[model samples]
Target chain A: DAGVTQSPTHLIKTRGQQVTLRCSPKSGHDTVSWYQQALGQGPQFIFQYYEEEERQRGNFPDRFSGHQFPNYSSELNVNALLLGDSALYLCASSLVAVSGNTIYFGEGSWLTVV
Target chain B: AQSVAQPEDQVNVAEGNPLTVKCTYSVSGNPYLFWYVQYPNRGLQFLLKYITGDNLVKGSYGFEAEFNKSQTSFHLKKPSALVSDSALYFCAVRESLEDFQKLVFGTGTRLLVSP
Candidate 1:
């Protein structure tokens, strides 16, 4: 079975531009979450999508948004990118019913804001 | 607010020796602890989690963690380390309350196992 997969593994965007990263959750998974990992820092939650609705969001700005499709795939969009937006964007997936709700992550999309 | 702390920025060990990475957490209610590993340029890989029932949680690749409720600690351990085990280890925690909460991760500890 295929695990979590992400697209545009590496990307470069200019300041004030927008970028969209895609992710396909692991097989049999339902929920999708987005995280941002800055250099030398741990990942910070951006938001989580369940049932095609954004269930929870973190302390991110309104520039960050996400969408979960009916097929359990997700897309993270960041608008008006700034220099600080350069980081590794990770996409994780999990089953809502699982006891601890263990999440599986994709390799992540690297974004460089120039 | 839930949070986790990994005190050590880096740890060095020899192959075939035992290893331990410390972690501490704070949460309002019960804490759901987790340990994950990451290679040079990869996503975080789930190693184990402590939701309930057992304090000693065993996970993939001969890894294990002991959860201490009072200490609010969940330290990752392994009996015999391998050179391939040299990677970054992260500790995360989430509140176990009825409300939904995202996992809070630490800065991560770099484990270097030498041959």
Candidate 2:
């Protein structure tokens, strides 16, 4: 079975430009979470989408936003991207149930903001 | 607040030797600990997890982790190391309850298994 998948494996955008990254959750997963991994650092939680709604958010600015479709697919959108926005954007999917969930990550979409 | 810590920046061990990657976590309630490995430019791969029952959890690639509640640590261990086992390892934890399951991850530790 195909695991979580992300689109635009690599992208380059000039500062102040906008970019949109897409993700399709695993076959049985209903929740999607986004993370940003900068060089020499751990992945930072961006936000989580459940039932097509944002349930939790991390320490990110208004420029970063996202949407989750009814099918549980997700898209992360960045407006007025800054040079510091360059990082590997990871999409993880999980099935939220009575038991605690275990998240599985995708290969990640690398964004380069110039 | 829930958090996780991986004290070592990197650990080097000779192939065929026992390998250990240290991890520690802090949480308000029972913790759901997890370990993941990442290769260069790739996503984190699920290694193993500790939720309930046994404290010594076995996982992929002949790796296992011991969950120490008293010390709030879940250190990854393998009996023998291989050059291919060298990669970045991450420690993460979340409240085991239905709610408050957002994962809090450590900075990660790079393990180098040299031949």
Candidate 3:
């Protein structure tokens, strides 16, 4: 009955460095998606993972990548981080058949790039 | 390109008063609309959605949304606003034809309920 869960509640990284944030989807969920919420802004879609492969992506560049495991957990990796990359990274889970219309989100990991 | 628009940057209302947050969207095909609320330092929580039912959709936390197909609008409403209802709200839209199933979100609206 646990909801979506994310790790490293807070992280700090510098320019050109890489960071990985983890998320465990809610029970009975099969798809995972990542989003970035900058200050004073709404959450922007990053990418989605289904069947252990990235099925959908947003306007993000190659610096952002993600992975979905057999257990339905997900990880979001950002490389060559820039100061603008500082934001709240959110992980949302849903069923593949659900059409990604309705999603459940985790508390999110706050990433700070300096 | 699908997109959502939340015209209000912030809204203020007294406790127990009715409140509304406006949203509009643009998409190619049948539009799947959603409303989500986000508290400080928390993830977005699903509030309500409009798929293909009555224009009026009710959801958790006493929230409801009315979808207007002709207007391409989905507005969230609450009969009696509570102080705890103060939060950031987002409207999203997804196109039925899109393969990625991505949701395009609006800029967000901040609601403040004062007692």
Best by lDDT: 1
- Per-residue lDDT of A104 in model 1: 85
Q: Compute DockQ for each candidate against the true complex.
A: 0.68, 0.63, 0.65
Instruction: List the candidate 3 regions with Cα displacement exceeding 4 Å.
Output: A99-101, B97-101
Tens-digit per-residue lDDT, B1-115, candidate 3: 8889999999999999999999999988888888999998888999988888799999999999999989989999999999999999999887773454478889999999999
Give the DockQ of candidate 3: 0.65
Which prediction has more favorable DockQ, 1 or 2? Answer: 1
lDDT of 2 at A95: 88
TM, every model: 0.97, 0.97, 0.96
**Predictions in order: lDDT:** 0.92, 0.91, 0.90
Residue B58, candidate 1: C-alpha displacement in angstroms: 0.4
Between candidates 2 and 3, name the one with more favorable DockQ.
3
TM-score of chain B of each: 0.95, 0.96, 0.95
Pick by lDDT: 1 or 2, better one? 1
Which pairs clash inside model 3?
none
State the lDDT of candidate 1 residue by residue for A38-85, as single tens digits. 989999999989899999899999999999999989999999999999
- Index of the highest-DockQ prediction: 1
Candidate 1: residue B78 Cα off by (Å): 0.4
